[model samples]
Target chain A: MARTLINLPKTAKAGAVIEIKTLISHPMETGYRPGPEGRLVPRDIITEFVCRFEGEEVFRAELFPATSANPYLTFTTLAERSGTFTFTWTGDNGFSQTESAALTVT
Target chain B: MRRALLGLLLLAVPAAAEIAPGERRSGFDQMTPELRAMQTDEAANPGQLWVGDGEEAWAAAPPTGRPACAGCHGAVATMRGVAARYPAWDEAAARPVDLQGRINLCRTRHQGADPLPFESRPLLALTAAVAAQSRGLPVAPPADPRLDPARAEGERLFTRRTGQLDLACAQCHDALWGRRLGASTIPQGHPNGYPLYRLEWQDLGSLQRRLRNCLTGMRAEPYPFGAPEYLALELHLMRRAQGLAIEAPAVRP
Candidate 1:
């Protein structure tokens, strides 16, 4: 899995709408079958992913098998008095990631 | 005034090559007969092994809780042209739906089959078998007023850019298609051949899957499977390559 890339507005009004972008590099295999040797590849997938502002969850998602590998999401959020925004990914592999960026509200 | 008008026209003119600018393609000139042959071989053989496995799964698993698709369709060859005609204008749904969506509907409503994941091999093989039926025929979507919205949506989605790279579909396929993107070349990335076998992927992939791949390549937040915007793009791409040959299970270098 490749590291995710996130792009958020460097600066925004204290209370303005901004689009947040996130992309992760994951093969996202929906382990429904075996790839080689007929052994089940095992069902491992990213089941939950979320974004938070200062420890407060802002956006959350429950992924299914239909979701593509390397999931990408675009969303809007109110820039409520900038602070540290954290993004996290939780997958079936028990693999999780947490990355954060500073947002300055002016 | 005429001279100035001509100048403006010249300024407006595009000097791009066959593909959109900033994109890379080996170009028709560089396409080797050998490479084309390899791809042709894959297409010719088709993924019979996988489809055969799917047929067995369909028979044993009983997704529909009815009988196997083999029992109803007998042989998939009889169901040819079904895929090419869908996201068909379903009278019941009143919309265009792709094979996966249709399969889901059938599994839930008709057969009680399980809805496989988007990239699942079973789903891929089943859809491939169905689409394979239309292997030789040109994709001809029905003409209806309802398709207007989808067409426009597709066009818009095709051109809109939303990513750190900030490049739209046109930027690559239309603007800098023939240009270099690092080491590899970019093809026009036409949708004529999908559920294609890409050397990079080493397996069959759908049109929707390709669109998601492009979004990732562009570093944009990609939409979900069966997303309206992406579906529109697929519809538009299929429409764009209307007369092109359907090259499924094709191998790309």
Candidate 2:
């Protein structure tokens, strides 16, 4: 499986804002480059990345070939309730990966 | 006459030309300071993702397998010196095999499981993980008289001109080492930090993937995965990387 990494605060106060970071290993092949035979390399890149906090959508991104490989994203979200934060990355070539982390609001 | 003379000169030089100890350096030495900074930091380096996954895979049996790798290997720490000694002669296969190939062999033969596809994420992850244990250890491929032929074949492949570009691996990597190839610096073509993270690739990949990329860059035909040529090339490259510290799960641009 493509490796995914996430950073989340272990503890946060209710109603306080928290930062989240995510990175995944992927080639994000742009399809523009030529192969050994001068044929165009097929374009394959992460097309969408979404993050949900406590089952509510908090951050999302539409990725493209221009996006760097191993897409890294940082965003802020409110620690409304102690719950699960689920992140999903969808891309070309049937590539889809999901990761989750727990946040405790004290 | 000139072409023959050039060939003669090339033949006079050993393909496995040794760099003096004082002068030998890994490709990482040629990177810009900023990239070096990123590669050196575990938190910033993306190769950690695969390393992490590799940690997970080590403990868990494949979906169908009865034995996990940890069943016999004990602790991951025991594997520290293991990766540095691979691309060794596999008596059963009667050929040289790298860490990845060895892992697949164990999976299929010992684990009673299907082998992961070459360049697949699971394979790359596991390879990175195994290699990570050897981080900072010097590479020391075992010396065996039986492997001499494979090593020689690898040297020939390294020095042979290929593709429309008609370039040999020695030209850009050896002759142009530390020089600029457009925006990027040419590396000495070491195989230490394989299953490495390439910013251009945006994903972790095997040494074979990188080799294929180079072939594409040269506008040359790439051999199929698991081909003897790649194994031979890997054998040759690992020797070239001798004495360099293992830095698997390394980051590259």
Candidate 3:
């Protein structure tokens, strides 16, 4: 299930400022419920998120226990470089998700 | 300003008893024997946290020097038949008393302890134990005319219009019977087995709790805890499910 929404600006100037936002829907449960085997479910959550442009890391975040269920993020970026920006979420239980969008600098 | 204030007021009511999230799952008619067995096991085990507390309440004598129903009633079996006949006409009081009221009476008059809050753990457990005693007994409303008024009140609540959803309680549970609202299916809304541990909630909740869910599902402002409206509805639904087995801790989507 793709939890995030990615919206790219239609176009951008070479040095123009650009904004991007993302939101994901998840319970992000605290693993408080005992599993079928009576063992507490491991704390599998999105602990890391990274956004990169043209192979350069533009933004990074380290999530903690307090991060609420539906996480949302917005940030400003420069259109000085034109290429694809990739977003990824990494966590326990091999949970991984990736999304990408392209920008053209003129 | 008037419109905005009205909207805010409307929002406040729904906010109090809002369903945590998502739609109430439907399709509850499909239950296998394995699922039924699982339900039995869950019910047999003491309810999470609450049951243990109730056991303590029952065994410990209060300082007020009131008689202990426990010393006489002993276990649920002794009082099971009593519940199935409740909200009945008490010729003495000449008015109806729901289970919560009755529990309060015992605590205040006989148990020597203060009455627990309507939706609190102690109250729920006491009600649970008392209601459990009537496990196999059929719901039998008192034949006296006194109950007619309360039952009429409940029926009115079930059909009343409310909320942004523009729904009445029966519009779905009664009119749309056997329909799917989302991932889960809906069954005939019955209260035979309450204090149920619904799978969707992943916790044991009272029928009133479920009513809160319904009010939220329909986007209506829910009545406050221990509200008269909810008690009336409870009485009505319990009577409706009269012939059905009391299946507390029952699983629902």
Candidate 4:
């Protein structure tokens, strides 16, 4: 399983906008770097990230080779009700991981 | 008579120039506000990835089925303040062993596993994880008589000039710290933070790696990883950094 860190308030007021931050461990190796034999290191990068609240999509991003190693992302989402936030990252070589955190709207 | 007195005063200058213990500053203090923020925020610090990996490794059993580190050491939290006393003297080796050395020793002797290569992800992850447990504790090198000789040798290495640049660690870190070195300010070169995430490398790394980088930058042949000289130097550094808080997994530019 990919190591990930997610930051969000455990509770938020209804209609309030809350910030969410995430970081995941991945080399995100761009194909440009050379190896010991001076051959290009093959490209490996996370291509997509999506977050859903109560099973409805809230935020999404399409990543590229330019993204750094251990990709970190921060965004804001509206809190409408108490639910779980599920985060998914899909990448090259069939690498995909899904993790979730719960939030309460009161 | 005046000339003789002036010569004596000149002889005293270098000794007096060493930074006083009360004045010592951590690399953390020298960082840009953004980098400091990055180090403080767990969610944003890239080093946390390694710590997370380490937490897993602590409990994982190798294919050989030997006990995991946690089996003997208990919870990782129990390791609090342990890193502060590293580069401690080892009776079995009759030499000093830094935190990484101790970890590798455990794998080989206790777990019956091959030692992980230096700079490898597994090694960095585990070292960072272990050091993170001591994050807020003051570095307290054990008062072991056996460590005295190694610490002395380390002090010599720190002050001795070599390499194409003909510089000693003290020339910059001790005498000229807080001064500008090209585009960056020279830091005091304390080891309070090890296994930190340097933005320039875009990866987590150990203190030995950082020291080697400095050696190479001076146009000197860096000793191979796990060299005794490096361990001696680490012992001295921890002693020199006494009372400084550990900041392993710190972020740096």
Which candidate's DockQ is highest?
A: 4
Compute DockQ for each candidate against the true complex.
Answer: 0.01, 0.39, 0.01, 0.91
What lDDT does the true structure give each of the candidates?
0.68, 0.86, 0.67, 0.91
lDDT string for model 1 (B1-253, tens) is 9999998878656433223323323233235686566545432333443444454554554733586666665766786776565555556777767766776666666677667788887787777666666776766766766877887788787777878888888877776655678976666766655566564664667778888888998899889987877667767766655555565545465
lDDT preference between candidates 3 and 4, better one: 4
Q: Candidate 2, TM-score vs. the true structure?
A: 0.76
Best by lDDT: 4
Which of the CAPRI classes, incorrect, acceptable, medium or high, describes model 4? high
By TM-score, who's the top model here? 4
Model 4 alpha-carbon miss at residue B161, Å: 1.3
Residues A3-100, model 3: lDDT tens digits:
46556685799899998776553445567758899999767567888999978999898887667554556688888967899998877677788889
- Tens digits of per-residue lDDT for model 4 on A1-106? 7789999999999999999999998989888999999999999999999999878999999999988888999999998899999999999999999999999999
Query: Per-residue lDDT tens digits of candidate 3, residues B127-157?
Result: 7666666665665666667677788799788
- List runs of model 1 lying over 4 Å from the truth: A1-106, B1-31, B42-46, B55-64
Per-prediction TM-score? 0.59, 0.76, 0.59, 0.93
> Mind giving the per-residue lDDT tens digits that candidate 4 earns over B1-253?
9999999989778657677889899999998898899999989999999999998999898667899999999988988988999988778888888888899999998999999999999999999999999999999999999989988899899899989999899999998999999999999999998999998898998888899999998888899988888988998888889999999889988
User: What stretches of model 4 exceed 4 Å from their correct place?
Assistant: B1-15
Off by over 4 Å in 3: A1-106, B1-29, B32-34, B42-56, B89-94
What's the TM-score of candidate 3 when only chain A is evaluated? 0.83
By DockQ thresholds, what CAPRI class is model 2?
A: acceptable
Tens digit of lDDT per residue, candidate 1, span A2-105?
Answer: 35667788899888998887766556777886878988787767888899999898999988887765566768899989798898889886779888888899
